[model samples]
Target chain A: MENLIDIKGVRHAYDTAAGKLPVLDGLEVSVKEGGFCAVVGPSGCGKSTLTRLIAGLMHPDEGEVWLHGEQVKGPRSTVGMAFQNPVLLEWRTILQNVMLPLEIVPGGLKGKAAVERAESLLALVGLEGFEDKRPSELSGGMRQRASLCRALVHQPDVLILDEPFGALDAFTREDLWQTMHEVKAKEPFTAVLITHDLRESIFLGDQVVVLSGRPARTQYVMEITRDGPPKLDDLYTPEASERLATLRHQIEIAQGRAEEGVSA
Target chain B: MTGTLRKILVPTAAMIIFLILWEALVWVMGWPNYKMASPSDLIPAYERYWELFLIMGWQTLWRTVLGLLLAIIVGTAIGMIMGFSRTMRDALYPLLVGFNAIPKATVVPIVALMFVGAHDFNTVLIAFMISFFPIAVSVSIGLSTLEPEYRDILRSLGASQTTIFWKIALPKTLPEFFGALKVSVTLAFIGTNLMEIVSPHGRGLGALFDSGKTNSDYPLMFAVLIALALLGIVLYYVVVALEKVFAGWAERQPG
Candidate 1:
């Protein structure tokens, strides 16, 4: 598979009242076309910064971020994003909210075509009856589903999930992970998921990348081999346990709790 | 009761109780009509000066409404400019605060003198000057405080600042805008009345109130006050209605 997203030696810093706060230092990552890459790291490890860099919302001070072999010079309309808060506009209905990107992204969809596309995506996320409902009327989980539909409405080249499920309860998060797989199977786009949950990373991602503490760099990368679509029961299996254990150890190392030489 | 019925019924009942209390208080005190006119006195006053009240009320209403409309346009423009740029906000905010701090009543004379012989224009000018501040402040706050996540979602789609403003900022700030309008509507009335009272051009409800004061016609003075209050209430409701139409999503169910 061809690399759809490539971040090489990305370094970024924020100028603060105190001084320059370095966030990303020599960070490197790549996700192949149609691949789900989950990035895990310590709190404030600049995982969110990495997503912005990939989405072209911001640029790195040094190194390159290439999407489909082209360097990102500025914000790209081809990127879709969802945050942990869902952040759906209170003024627009769920369907209208989903169609928001379509309106902004030029030559995407229009009129009846846009409505139909948004309705179909809403249906895919099991939000069929909520087409006319406001964002406040929906539950947290439901709002997140609508947010996901909005992100994908324009058929963007890359979809970025920045801790999108962090605020949801465990059960809701797991259900959304399944919904994510179903959506991706139909939509077929490369994705970068920034998450804190190790299980969530493994359950949804084909490959999980771990990052070290502040001024984060790619610490380790683990690829999961699964025979079929992910199932909740598979999480309890021996192979899954082994993968989880290895990833947990990597996270502990990333958080500087354990040494790299220590065996798991 | 349904929400709408209760909304209307509660205020109506309150007004009736208030009027009865005022009538009883005046009757018990045995105050003469010139010293204090009760609600009962207002009816005869209305009958005697119905034509004057109608004409003056119309003048005041139109001036206030016109000034409010101008304020909306100018305030929204200034708010958007400030909202879009930090440099502009920083530069303009202090000046706005200082201008707003000075009493609008004091400025009415200045405005009347500046545009002498233009009574209506002066009245409208004072109304605009008084009301625009709330609107500009509300709109700026609304724009500046927009959620970062929403901006990221739009910017990631390569949306221009103009597109963001039209699609997100305007709609998002509507609740605040309407809030400001409600406050501005009342302020506009004050501005109009101030001009009418200070530099009475022999027009508007304020002028009628002033003439009644001079003649010691207590009932007529109170009548004009009631008319002004009624106008303010009507205009405030108009703003509330517009808010429901534009920013109904912000209205949450009362717990």
Candidate 2:
């Protein structure tokens, strides 16, 4: 199977007033075709940077990023992303926000069919009747749901979620996680999610890539198994809980080193 | 009992009280009627030159409205260019700010002298000068704050620049554009009036007031001043009403 996303020893850093600060230092990770991969790390440890490299929002200072076997030269609209903040446009209604990408993309989506596509996407996220309501008029959870629809509306090959459920309450986040699982079951797509939630990473992602501290690179990759049906029943089992704990310890140790470097 | 009445009650009561005090102060101090006309005394003055005052007021209003409209159109265009292009903004913003800092009233007479026009072009020019900067600054700020998430989302979805501007930029900046206009309208009126005070062709309330002062016809001056007040109030209320109609959109806006 072709690797939908291929990142090989990518290095990136941003220019700041102080000086150049390193982010990703020779980090490599690849998402297998149709696999849900989550990169979990401390804040600013280049987990989100990996998403940008894959989505073509930013280029790696050194190294290659490939999407669907093609080298990413610049931004390709074929990747869909939702940020931690819902980022729903205030002026646009829920449905219109979801329909925006299709209008922008050269999909030739027009008239009633386009509208129906938007409606089905909105219905998929359980915001069926909220077609005419603006983002400001909706609750935080509802806004995020609308955001999911917007991400999927154009049917992009890759969907990237950067802490997508970070701002939501625990209950809402869990609910959306289940919804995402169902959505994936129906229409399988390659996704790279950057998250801090270990259980969430284990629950939704087929592969979990854990990073070292700042100036970080891929340190570990763990594969999760679902024999037949993807169910929430085994989320808190001993094996899953132990894995979650070990992931937490590794992240904490990596973070302590980063903090010490900052002080020094 | 009435919604409309409730809206105006505080301002109306305050105005009534002010008039009553003015009437008392004049009568008690033995101030001459010509020196300071009370609200009741100024009532006749409005009727005496009703036709002339109306015409002058209309001229100023036209100048103010057209000037502000022009400011929004030109300002938003320039602002969008500045907002989207970093090179343009860095090069132009400082120069624009320098222009904004210079008071229009000081330069109005010179501008009017340079332009040859039979109509109230001087007043219009003054209004435009005063309004232009505020509109430009507000629109530039509004457009610059175009949410990085917006570009990210659109880029990921394969959105082009033109579509982003029309569908995204225009609607987002709308509330702020109107807010800028609200500020611009007030300045436009002041600038036009200041020009009227100096221009050869200005027969507006400013000139009328100047004439009344020179001729020592305080009653006529007071009456014309009242008419000018009414004019300002009308223009201000018009913008306020527009904001009311667009309030739903404004409420959604982030500051």
Candidate 3:
């Protein structure tokens, strides 16, 4: 598989009033074309920063980020993003909010074409009739679904999700995972998901990358050998449980919460 | 009562109770009409001097409206500049604070001096001066509150600053703009009234009060007060209605 997205020796730091705070150090990642890569790390591992770097929203303090064989100098129209919070404009209806990118991206869809694209995307997320409703009127799950539609509306080459369903209940989160899987399967874009949920990472990602603590580097990378997208029932299987336990143990040691050489 | 009916009835009942208490206090105190007039005296006064009140009240209301309209344009432009540029904010914020500190009433007299014989211009200037600061400050604050996440999302989509301003910043500032308008509209009325009170040309509500005070016609003075109060209430409600129409998204809908 060809590398669709690549982050090479990237380092990022924030200049706080106190001092310079380093977040990512020599962090390298690569995703193959049409791959869904879920990045899992301990909380505060600068996972969000990585997403920003990939999306080209900001420049890295050092090193290079490449998308589709070109260096990412600035924000690209071919990159789509959804955050943990829906961040829907309160005044816009669901359909309008989903269509926001089309209006912003240069030479993007417009007028009736934009509306039709938004309508079909909404339908994919099971938000068909809720098009005219304000975000406040929608449930938390519904809002996240709408947000996903917004991110995908412009049909970008790479989709970056920063814990997109982190605020939802467990049930809703799982349901959205299935929705996301279906969307990716149908649309076939390279996806990079930053999440704290390990189970979610394995469930949705073809490849999972884990990062260590602050000033994070890639600690471990796992490729699931599953034949197809895992169903909800697969999560309850013994094989899934063993994989979960192994990942949890690795994360505990990586976060410095457990001794590396000791058995619990 | 239904929710809609209760909303209307509750405020109406409160107003009725307030009036009854005011009447009782007047009767018990036995304060002459000059000091305190009951609703009985107030209603008859309105009927007898309806023409005077209407003509003068119209003059005051139009001046207030004109002044407020000018303030909205000037203030919002200044606000957008201040909001978009850090240097502008740093340069102008202290100056605005200092200008707002000076009593607007005192400026009225200075404006009168500058204009000399132009009473209406002086009145409008005073009104503009009085209401400008609040609108500018509110709009600037609203623009500043554009969320980091929103910026990130828009930037990721390759949105330019101009697009962000029209699509994001402008709509977000509307609720704050309307809030400032409500406060500034009242200030505008005060500005118009201040000019009318001090000016020799007494053609508005302020002039009615000035003449009534000179002649010791307490009923006429009280009548003017009622008209001013009604004018303020109506204008405030108009702003409230406009806010509901334009920025209804900011309001909390009942479940």
Model number with the top TM-score: 1
Cα shift from native, residue A235, model 2 (Å):
2.6
DockQ of each: 0.84, 0.61, 0.80
Error of model 2, residue A191, in angstroms: 1.2
lDDT of each model, Cα atoms only? 0.93, 0.81, 0.89
Reference-based lDDT, residue A41, model 3: 83
What candidate 2 gets wrong by more than 4 Å, as runs, is: A256-264, B1-30, B86-93, B116-119, B241-247, B252-255
RMSD values, in order shown: 1.7, 3.7, 2.5
List the candidate 1 regions with Cα displacement exceeding 4 Å: B1-7, B253-255
What range of 10 consecutive residues in model 2 chain A has the weakest lDDT sum? A255-264
Of 1 and 3, the candidate ranking higher by TM-score? 1
**Residue A34 of candidate 3: its Cα lDDT?**
91
lDDT of 2 by residue, A50-81 (tens): 87787787888999998888999888878888
Q: Could you give candidate 3's per-residue lDDT for residues A1-264 as a string of tens digits?
A: 679999999988989999999999888899999988999888888999999998888899999999999999999999888989989999999999999999988898999999999999899889989999999999999999999999999999999999998999999999999999788777779999998898898898888888888889887788876876669888888988887877787788778988766653
Off by over 4 Å in 3: A258-264, B1-21, B43-49, B86-94
* Pick by TM-score: 2 or 3, better one: 3
